[model samples]
Target: MGSMAFSKGDRVVWNTPQGRTEGTVVERRTSDFQLDGQKFTASEEEPAYVVESASSSKRAAHKESTLTRRS
Candidate 1:
């Protein structure tokens, strides 16, 4: 795979099963449950991404393929 152009604090958009949601990158993780000492299990094949909503300030974690950098 290519080096995904994403980092913490980056504004982004993603497609969930429900709909598209916009947010900022709150985290990037490998195949582990512990990120920055907190437990968050996600794999590289299905890595977990943490984001905070642009409108609501709510946060959520999701898969990489579901996310895209905001233009």
Candidate 2:
């Protein structure tokens, strides 16, 4: 897998149950952390992005491979 390259405020899109959802890159997590009692293993080589959905206004974490940067 490729490394994470997204930064805060970056426009991105990812697949969802309904369809493709657009969002902004809220933060980049490089170290291991937990969210809502769920453990997330992240590192410099495999980071996770915290994104805020534009339509639902909800926040979620996602891997870089699952996101596509908007032009």
Clashes of each: 1, 0
Q: Candidate 1 on 1-71: residue-level lDDT in tens?
A: 44664679888898767788899999877676643456767775667888888878877776676778788
**Which number leads on TM-score?**
2
Candidate topping lDDT: 2
Colliding residue pairs in candidate 1: 33-40
Residue 1 C-alpha lDDT in model 1: 41
Question: In candidate 2, how many Å is residue 49 off?
Answer: 0.3
Q: What is the TM-score of each candidate against the true structure?
A: 0.69, 0.87
Candidate 2, superposed: residue stretches over 4 Å from native: 1-4
- For candidate 1, the TM-score is 0.69
In candidate 2, what are the lDDT values of residues 6-61, reduced to their tens digit? 99999999999999999999999999887667788889888999999999888888
